[model samples]
Target: MSKIVKKTKHKKKGIKIFSSALVVLDSKSLVFFDHKTFFELKFPKNTVNDLEIVGLENLNEALHKFIKENKITSNNIIMVLNSNLFFEKILKDSGDIYKEISNFIELTPFEEVCSRTIQLDGETRILSTNKKLVTTIKDILEKEGLDIQLVIPYLALDKHSLNTENILEVNGKKDLDQLLKQLLPYNLLTENTVLNGKPAEKPKKEPKRQLFLQERENNPKSKRPLVLLSIFIALIFVLIGLVLFMNRKPPEEFTAPEIHQSMPLIAPIGSDQQEQTSGKTVENTTIKVVYDNNLDSAVLLTKGLSSLGFNSVILEKAGSESNTSKTYIDFSTNYPQSLRDKLIGETNKIFVDTVVQDSEVSDYDVVITL
Candidate 1:
């Protein structure tokens, strides 16, 4: 368990930095430390629903007013869902995050390469070690009605006492048990531990119970065989891929017995009467023209946004959160879901419920409805 969460040791100087729950309302303050510092922020004075937060509204009013009053430099935040939110298959054909495991979970311009791809607040067990802390933070957030900007793990530390370089491996109950005893306060293991559904917990640690990593490893063995693990993982990938592949309107198709009926057979044909594939995609040089209703100057600024990579663009109408951010830009052709983030970033506008269905552009992508 420690091995999984341990910091990747480096030869460079190690910095002992203090951490705190950070909330960023404005961008200017923490622009320099985006990666190093965990952050949850919003533009000040932006109304989210019926509430408004002053970008300068000190969450820790007076008690620690020095942070803002004196312009101090400190805060540790970590509230990134992309870090550990869903099952992911590091794509072999594409590295773009907009290409994810599901159509249900929308992708955004922001992507973080933290410990896990996602960590659902509840009912998530794959990364069981972080569950308790995750749930604890989730409760606090919901109860306080305070949308968190970040929540660094309380057990997280780079101290030499817990040698980050050590390696421990075990398959049997005895070996696994010994391994659990080593990780002290950080270890979330139960004293009445269970292996193969039987009880086994050593009486130690302040808390009587903790999440035994070895026990979690055992849970899989009881449910299914090891050979099926590969098949299960593969099945999950296909399931997600199928969802993303839906609603994609390629130019042509044909029946092939060898091709699985479950998979859509779209043979992409360009304007040159050439057949291409998902593998041979290259960056486009064509201009995109957007006409969003949200912004007054959307048409004038549309050309610039297109140059940034939108194949063809036009606007539709916008929607709401939990609802969909919409944008229907009539291009000369079709497009894909991949356009969501680029469109959002380029125009500084969001499409909660949008789609681009253009017939004029012959070699465009797909008609996105995301």
Candidate 2:
């Protein structure tokens, strides 16, 4: 039977929260489609953070992990302009013939644009072309072996800061805004959301924002009540302590215990191993895992072995069957994610212990994924 000790006390270190990342960037190779001032670019009531970048090639992997941890896949992102590499050239000659012309021009190689953003997919429309150099950027893409599917014609245009209502005279932007209205969805920006229309009255926030406001409304009162309660609790505790001290019966703890002593030999920790604190107990253990595929799985399994207080964990892939008529296991950790994902690709095969296999992969310890 365990008794709750009232007087006996132990000190503990307060827990520290591990900070989470909201944004992870590859580099400054970005272009901002910002219509608002930089001051308005951020949220007034939310927190924003970024991560360190290594290189462009590893950008996808970094973004994958970042999105996984934040539990968010899509959000408004700000991309920086790489001034050293990117250029903004407003072509005037290819206005009406943009789609036909840009298809040939983007293939023209600009060494500066080579390391910059690649065209994902886009439509071309002439922004009043006068006359300029035209070339397709296909050679650069071919040199990189990138299969281009999206031919998004990005205008190498100069940044203009002007609102439609403010401008009294039209400055050659007649059909562009109409075309822009059609293309707003592709930009992921709000439709009819530009400076042309009467400024929206900042639409009433959804219920989501109301929750925050409600929390704020309750916070001050809650804190005040909490403080008052704490003071009351402290007063009661002090009273009890004072009473106990005044009429104390005294503690009977003069002698040390005469329990038998024993010699213990602790095995030295392995070089690749570390001590594990599980829940509230210390344990000596050994773990074993077998994974037939994935270099990362092998690495993670080895790491889990030591992290779990295990003596050792061994992993071995299933080899070609020793006997005839053995079914082949198309095991992989590539794009498919799991066997089910690769199931349509690999049919007529019996799955042995599918849940058990997937559970170990699905129930991993990390907050993010590869």
Estimated TM-score per prediction? 0.16, 0.18
Model 1 lDDT per residue over 1-370, tens place? 2122323333434532333222322211211122133322222233121121232224223213323443434322232222233223332224332223222122311121112222223211121223332333334333433343333222222221322222111334454344334322222222232222234334344233232322232343455766688899999999999987995678677776695589788976653333133321224423433332435555545555656655455443335432435554443333333443455445445344455456654444433223
- The TM-score that candidate 2 achieves is 0.18
Per-structure clash totals for the candidates: 42, 20
Q: After superposition, how far is residue 222 of candidate 1 from its true place, in Å?
A: 49
Candidate 2: list runs displaced more than 4 Å: 1-57, 68-87, 92-107, 110-370
**lDDT, each prediction:** 0.34, 0.28
Off by over 4 Å in 1: 1-285, 288-296, 299-327, 331-341, 344-353, 356-370
Q: What 10-residue stretch in candidate 2 is worst by lDDT?
A: 128-137
Q: Give the Cα error of residue 350 in candidate 2, in Å.
A: 99
Least accurate 10 contiguous residues by lDDT in model 1? 108-117
